[model samples]
Target: MAGTTWDIPSGATVKVSIIDSTMRLSNMPTTMLFDNAVEDFDHLDRIPTWCLLVESASGRKAVFDLGAPTDFDTYAPVYNKLMNEAGLRSGFKVEKDVAQVLQDHGVAPADVSSIIWRSEGLPVSVHSSHQHLDHIGNPNTFPKSTEIVVGQGFTKAYCPGYPTNPDSPVCETYFADRTLREINFEPGPAANPKIGGFRAHDFFGDGSFYLLDTPGHTTGHLSALARTTHGDIEDTFILMGGDVCHHGGELRPSPYQSLPDPLTASHYPVPAGLNITGCPGAALFGALQTSRGRRARDEPFVDPSKQLQEDYAASGRSIREAQVPDAMDNVFFVFAHDATLLGVVDVFPKGANEWRDKGWADTARWTFLKDFAPAAAKFGEEK
Candidate 1:
């Protein structure tokens, strides 16, 4: 994780916007609400949404995750019920559909050369549980040439890191190629995208953006980062998040503390509630967030380590303590599911900022892999 690959274009600015794709399912519990005394929430699931646009340094446009299929409008009541429960209104009214959102933004699947999936396809709307339709709107509907990018271990589960957690309301029944193969139409390699250090393809390498294997959430829950050196990275827009944590909610104590109380037998997290067959401690140890960290302790619950173990194959290798390269400085991590301060990203409506506000910052950007082990050796909680 040391030595970031700065081969990407510099001085470019990459910005992101959270699009109102769809709200979370109804019947979310109370404990899960209010994620961020430091981050985002006041209850309700972090309605699985999509980040519409990313303008790279060269002004190239990239769409991170595509919104659900346009036909979802018919189920307006369910989604509306969800938003109403959250006590929040979407900034964009197009929640009815993303078709207009895409057209208004001038982005079509063909125009979008980069496609990074946070997880696999879920049939939730049509299927019960982590049904393929519940998530991953379906890419087969998109232009074939659009790159079908995904993390190394996307095949294991389509519920982002949900499958990894076990207790997740979503059932880890779907496979990547099994569920997602239907949506894929890319003409290029399905093998891993080239990323050495922070060195990524940029997809087009013009500074548009590329995916980084963040792992954890799933075996290879990847994060998309777009960099534009708006001045030095002292203030860069990074989105270091994923399903491992929702919004910034898991970062603090109040919301996280409430989690255990509501945990039930049916909805209890797989790892959190059950004892792993071979592992020694509690199964939930590695699955949920703790006062210490949201890791599955019994079997080295940090799913990211498994990704590293896979030789970075399926992002199942050992990325623990692997330092994020310096070249990633100007980048903003776009996977807001995890609560790492380095994750959640905030952005204004495209033209809102007098300045081109691309991402959010203020959280400490830990040093590279080279210094991490030693530094973390000294890093500790006051408790």
Candidate 2:
């Protein structure tokens, strides 16, 4: 774990609030997104899309990843047709847009300095993690002065969207009449420093926030690291992992954070007649490891399948790189669609800056194992 440590520069801290974007997808096939050959979960039900409200110390506010629009019709016709064909139309629903969620919390849409789709910065801008429909939201709701920010190569890949390109999944209206700024992660005077194996840009020109160039999910997929608390000896961070991997299982149990020896019933409750105390982590969930042949104790439960990823190999690399931060005790990694945090962490109206103090990381870490309870029960019975 020596080389895995993050050399974080001491600096200002930001206020982070987890926003329940109100987007939900139930009964989604696990196989559609992940390779679940080892972990046998049929459907990834109650999938929630999470956005973040990041406020810099200077009072500049930014919303990261707007979730989906309340109206599915807001998306491009091609995407809608694809959803209908895939039978995903019924499973998807959104009660409110991110803008409305902010308003309910007393934050006005106009007051939002920027909307980070997947990247982060000051001034009025919208930064998208990728051009995916669920993360794009409705940019039109914000004032035109609020520019849209995206990761590097975003415009080149999906610009002139929809009707203009006919096959584009993005809508041209997202960029119309607004300044569409794409991040340049190239190393130079702008300071694209290497942080945890990814080229990161200091969004605030301070160490408070960094937009990591985490590609693989898409052409310009991005992830973020927010310095929530600064201390003399250590700093706490919240990693806004935007679709790095849909499930926590895909990013956990790395060489740094292996499965706990005695997987307790509190975290992973088993059926009656099984071990009332607890079960050995490896014995209960060993088969869940996706690594072939000689399985390592630290291998993940699953890996992102090639079906949804634009670059499968790159995604694998990014996921591996992400494990470093995920394994750290001071870093709390939250995925965009981690339903495990539904009632676990405070959302929106409550700031998540104190995640460390509340021990949210340890509480939510193994909670994802609940998804494998059925499999664990079956394994216990066979013994």
Candidate 3:
């Protein structure tokens, strides 16, 4: 976890924006998050596959995740089947593709210079946060000239994707003939000890963007940290937390911040009847008998160390510590699936670089806690 810190030059700025693919889907509770309960609520919950657009000061532009695809059938059969079983097979339509979203913002697929996974290519490359279908967003949809980037160990883990593997979730053509650069996080002796508990590589080499080695969700999952503002020594940053923590609640309520009561929380428009005046942290769902229900104290939970999906809870804890409240305006954690950000921050064409002024971090801080309102009301008082 040791790595050197890269310094951002003063006055250098990166234009950042949240691009809405407008792709939405209804999912069972435990599908997006591990320990949640769907049967406890009356209906299913939905979230958007939000993407990011980061443009460097020198005019180099790159896109983060591609969000969901308009023509999802183009993806591998294995992915299609999984989405089908997960109830996410049909909600996707073409109009919300990442290409369309970029065009709407006056940028075209041909104009982009790089495709950084999890985060860009030329006018340079297309990068994936990991190999997940939603994160990759049908990379073949991008211009063929654009290079594809991934985190360390990607090729060895999933190189001959799809068709070849039959059950592979990625398409083989995505990496075929493309400049697929896998990020090697091995830092030299001069590098610092660590960058937020993970190895990091200064992506631009100029200190503006850093590719972090945050594995857990998948074999090669990666996250990006961008310096939003330059200061004397330490600068402010926007942590593009790919799939590290799907929900805000998964990372909030650290030592630096606590859950906001109904009256103080401003981001979410609390309904007329539900009043969690003094709500504590996230509301916990009572024990149920579902296939993935919580195990009793006597029963053993899955050892995170051995899970093939990586250490989700450990990743959540790392992100939580990085975005603590007192950590100053220096850090803003943007998990890919945090629905609370839908209206809090402006979308593409309107950059989220103004997040500090807009108080977006504080606004959306405790909004996720509201999701448990109904469950809390039905159960006893907040714990």
Candidate 4:
């Protein structure tokens, strides 16, 4: 668990940049994401989609997660129906697709060597983190030479997509005339080794990037870890957590990184007239703990939605394992829909390799706690 360490070799590093997908899902019910037993908040005001551009030292480029398609109508009829049934039609909005965003940034689609999601290549290959519509994007936009990479069970689960499997969430056109490569993480003579409690494949074999087997959100959910700076006193990494947890509350306050005591204004701006300068961390956030067990303080504020998760227990383990690197100063964890990072971090066309030197982690770490302002205010009033 918390004691686990990553054995990242010292070698070539990659340049990573965040891409604002211009996709926004607003006014989503909080209950749809996690249990709202404590009733801290009613709705998630804004959910922004974030994608990443990874470039190896050798000039090979890859895009991680395409966010959402510009047009919602382009989705499979079944997926559209599901969204309508879930009453999410009005909430979903995308102003531009990933391809368009890339073009706007001066990076042509054809020049991108790979697009890793659940899939990865130059001529461009698309990797999908999972079969979710938001991440799959519109692979058809890329040249047919662009391959498609996916996780282990993806082919059997949703292949021959759409009309071929009427209920499929993906489109058959995505895989049409494209090379579909599925990553195998099983142990064998040439199998990928374990890195920090995860089965990892060295994508470039130069220690620049790795694709981790992290299932639970879906059948073939994948996450990536990129070495941004190496051959230094301490190597810095950016863990591209693909929906490991939607909100920061679900990943923070682990045993390794407990809530700061004597909570300060810098970490969280206390609402005015609280009549208190500083408060004990436990006392203020105690009620917000969804778990009543002994390790409630060490556990997350909220759990993953069972309805959306394929395996509830596995998802919990994945999140807990992620807490280890997250507590480290050298690792910066960014998930797909973290709105807290909207304007805080530099977006695409700007390299995120200097995150460590820029102190982005320290600034972004406690910002997520602002969402719990209401709970803190209530605690202050009671005090």
Candidate 5:
């Protein structure tokens, strides 16, 4: 058995909320719901910063995607005005962060045994998700004994840049959990599998939830997912996808943004600019270069595309990015920020107890994923 199978307990429940909802922070991340006044520009995804909490049969509770960067409210007037014009506002906090979230259900961050990030990226500032400061914003805020689960490659590939060793004081592996498989592979399996800090990972099996290597946006960037079955009639599902796509403009690939312009170099297709510095594609390209040199001949290196997420249309975040896991048919994509997702989904008002499984089930979000859980039963555990 890879791990525990899903046995929906009477006490076991998962809760999700939009944490941050501001557009005037640093640059409106591709995820935040910031509208674009410029006709030439794309619309914004003004989604609230959201943190997810899940309680297990063993009484263990965990949170996903802590909160966006703290400095989002301090933006200049021009940016704030633009965000306001586009219907953007801020409402993200930390103490009230997970504290309120937990208390609402009778819990606290201190009670949380672990805080597993969908991808470790800092709030509001750094553009990359693979780095420590990017993900483990203020480790002190978490419980003194709380464990941080950095995805396989995020743990390995990013250690070098940390102020200390990965196993040192700040960031350490929560478990021996590691792997190097392309999580997006169909049939739900792959090999050469040692956890790669450079690739993506799936924490436990049962494929209920896992990590994805969400490249293109950052060097060692990864995303998170949770497979859940909803509905009494058909037993549909909801998927919580963290940072796979920032906003509506990003869900779909855009001509790699003016393919040949230097000013737009940051947005070029992930595979095209392998020689650039500090880019994730460059890292894979560099790895290939090293491999070829050792072989004494030019060999076509490993393909980074294989490790990339297939689509951001909800299914884009799944294992094969094809069909929604069997347990779920409808999925709620918990993007940290995205105006469209925010516009479409209702944000629970403060002190209001009105909450239900109102996810992207009926909208385009539902059609985005495939139906796969029923077929995945045969994909069995492999060594």
Candidate 6:
């Protein structure tokens, strides 16, 4: 397995907030995210895409991921068709783009300063976590001065998108007049020892924020780690996990946090209510069914191979270990597709910079378990 250890500079800190683009989707099959399941699973999951806005104590600003496009069908037809066929739809109302979201939160579009995938320019430049339609949104929607920064290999892989490629999922209009920059990943101090085997680029050069090369969910996929502070304490980090895993379960019940033993379940509260014990991670599965009406195992629910871009099992293990309970106090994960977060942490206008004070991690740690309660109950009955 790839190493799961991360290196955080002692006393390093930054200001981070969750940007609620106010996007939402109605449906997604559980099998697409997990193995061992039945197809056409109507999870009605809140497929929300979120971006993270980070500010250094010195006032340098950066935004990650743009959430969803309001006019998605028109922006990217191929994506629209695929999503529509899969029962997914646009999630937000009109004018909910990133620029508007920033403006609504008191930061005018002109104040953006920079879009950090890895550092600034209201020079209107934005950093895309990946090329997915949802993450790119309508970059064209930004001011004419805006440019876009993407991970390495982006243009070569999907350039001449849309009409030119005919089947490309990205909009040519989005990149028409914009300057696109790709980050070149080099083995540095962050990557020499390996943080979950990820090649990281220190965005701020002060060790306060890092853009990790975690390429599994999609090619050139990137995730971030931002050091933050509560009151006097430092050495805390908030991980902006971009599409790492759609649901929390995929990275929970780690070796560091197995299902609570029944004797200690009362202390945990949430999982106790579901009466779940032992490692529930393995028991939790997708909703795809076999030809004989039994739930499918080791079978993909969607086209091509599984949606997982790399070794799925290894990726899950790396994430789970990196986010164990001992690390929760100083580290927490903010996944792009986790809707359970809506109720747990303060949204954009209100920075999650104070998550530690709010006990946000503890509150959300087990919320994903509720989705598996029925399965857990059935397992209990069988036992």
Q: Which prediction has the highest TM-score against the true structure?
A: 2
lDDT of 2 by residue, 25-103 (tens): 8887777777653445688777888899989989888888888888878777766766666676677788999989999
Segments of candidate 5 deviating more than 4 angstroms: 1-38, 42-47, 69-105, 122-135, 160-162, 165-208, 212-216, 230-234, 252-329, 343-383
The superposed Cα distance between candidate 6 and the true structure at residue 148, in angstroms, equals 1.8
Cα deviation of 220 in candidate 2 (Å)? 0.4
Q: How well does each candidate superpose onto the true structure, as a TM-score?
A: 0.47, 0.91, 0.79, 0.90, 0.48, 0.77
Q: Candidate 3 lDDT, tens digit per residue, 1-383?
A: 11223333333568788888776655433433444433344333557767888888787887877776777787777666665664555544435778777887689887766666662210000132112456677677678777777877777766577788876666788878777888888878323224656777776656677777776666667787777876675566788887766665445444444333333335445445775554322223222111335332112111222222455665555455444422445577787777888778888888887687788887776676456455544454523
Would you give me the overall lDDT of model 1? 0.37
Off by over 4 Å in 1: 1-12, 22-24, 30-48, 56-60, 70-94, 105-110, 122-135, 153-201, 232-235, 252-334, 337-383
All candidates' lDDT scores?
0.37, 0.77, 0.60, 0.74, 0.36, 0.59
Task: Rate residue 301 of model 6 by lDDT.
Answer: 25
10 residues in a row with least lDDT, candidate 6: 119-128
Off by over 4 Å in 3: 1-11, 36-44, 91-94, 119-132, 189-193, 231-234, 260-268, 272-308, 312-327, 379-383
Candidate 5 per-residue C-alpha lDDT over 24-115 given as tens digits, one digit per residue, 9 for 90 to 100: 23333322222222111222223345555544435565566555434433332333344355443442233343444445655655787667
Q: In model 5, how large is the Cα lDDT of residue 178?
A: 32
lDDT of 1 by residue, 1-383 (tens): 22343343443455555554543444333233221121111233344554556655455555555545544432223343443454433322224344346556565545655455554332223212222222344454445555555655454433442346533323323233333321221235532244444223344444435555554434445555554335543434344343433332222112112222232332211233332332221223212334335432211212321211223342323132122332243444334332222123443234311222433332322111111121122221111
What's each prediction's clash count? 57, 11, 34, 12, 37, 13
Using alpha carbons, what is the TM-score of model 5? 0.48
Residue 105 Cα positional deviation in candidate 6, in Å, after optimal superposition:
2.0
C-alpha lDDT (0 to 100) for residue 246 of candidate 2: 89
